[model samples]
Structure formats: C-alpha cells, structure tokens
Target: MQDHTVISSLIVRVLPDHGESAAARLASIEGVEVHEKLEGKIVVTIEAPTVDSSHDTAASFSEIPGVIGVDLVYVNFEDDPAVAKGSQR
Candidate 1:
C-alpha cells in the first residue's frame, strides 16, 4: 500500500521572552522544522505521512507552553509509491 505525504508551513506566535525556548521545542518534534524566529513569531514547517498526521503535528505546536497561536500558511500533499517496479534485462 502507498501512503500520502503531507507538508505544511505554519506561523507560530509566542511570547517574546519565550521565543527561543518555543523554537527549540518546536524543532524537537519529529517532522517539524523551525525556519526562522524573530520577536514573537516563528516560521515552521511540518511533514507527515498523512493529512491527519500533519494536522495533529500542527496542533501539537499550540500545546507548547509559550505558544500563543498557530496559523497554517501552506499545505501540500503527494502520494508515495509502495515499491519501485522498473526492471530491464
């Protein structure tokens, strides 16, 4: 079976004093990447095997201690093939 891959970008707002810590925590998540952090805003990306997983990952950001908001900025989905079938003899 093939699995769908979902990629998404989010803008997270945190308390100014906690931005650094928040970024660190976000970067720790399995498929999350913290691209930029300035003032109280953080730009991040999350990649998961499914749309539901992506949403769950994004929602997890909102549960972080200093996170004030999570706004999804972009999303993309692609199918992953289960196996390669090219052969020649």
Candidate 2:
C-alpha cells in the first residue's frame, strides 16, 4: 500500500502570556509546524497519515498550556494511490 498524508492549516488562539510556550509545544509534535504568531493567535500547519489522525492532532492542540481554541482554516487532501488507480483521468 502507498502512503498518503493529509495536510492542513489551523488557527490556534492562546493566552497572550503563554503564546510562546504553546507554540513551542505545537512545534514539538511530529508533522506540526508553527508558522506565524500575533497577539494571542498562532498559525500552524499539521500533517498526518490519515484524515482521522489529522483531526485528532488538531484537537490535541487544546491540551497545550494557554490554548483557548483551535480552528481549522485549510485542508489539502492527498490523493490515495490505490484509489487513484481505479479512476480515469
């Protein structure tokens, strides 16, 4: 089987005082990248082996210190090779 990954972006709101700490935690996660930060919000991208894992990873952000809310902003789904083989171009 071929491996496909799901890529997505999220807006994470955090307590301003702990913004840096939260971002560090997010960056420590595999497939999670902290891109930008302002006020109390952070922009991040997350990738996972599957959709369920992607959502789960996003939800886990709330566990970080100072995290207020996690909002999914964008998603780029990868084409599954097995499924692609059955479809016509």
For each candidate, give its TM-score against the true structure.
0.81, 0.83
Span of ten consecutive residues with least summed lDDT in model 1: 80-89
Q: Clashes in model 1: which pairs?
A: none
Per-residue alpha-carbon lDDT of model 2 for 1-89, expressed as tens digits? Answer: 33546789999999989999999999998889999998999999987776777888998998898999999999876564433555655
Candidate number achieving the greatest TM-score relative to the actual structure: 2
User: Which 10-residue window in model 2 sums to the lowest lDDT?
Assistant: 78-87
Instruction: Tell me each candidate's RMSD, in Å, in order.
Output: 7.2, 3.9
| Alpha-carbon lDDT, every model | 0.84, 0.85
Tens digit of per-residue lDDT, candidate 1, span 1-89? 33447779999999988999999999999888999998899999987887778888998887898899999899886442221222221
**Candidate 1: misplaced stretches above 4 Å?**
1-4, 80-89
TM-score of 2: 0.83
True lDDT of residue 59, candidate 1: 85
What number of backbone clashes does candidate 1 have, counting pairs of residues 3 or more apart or in separate chains?
Answer: 0
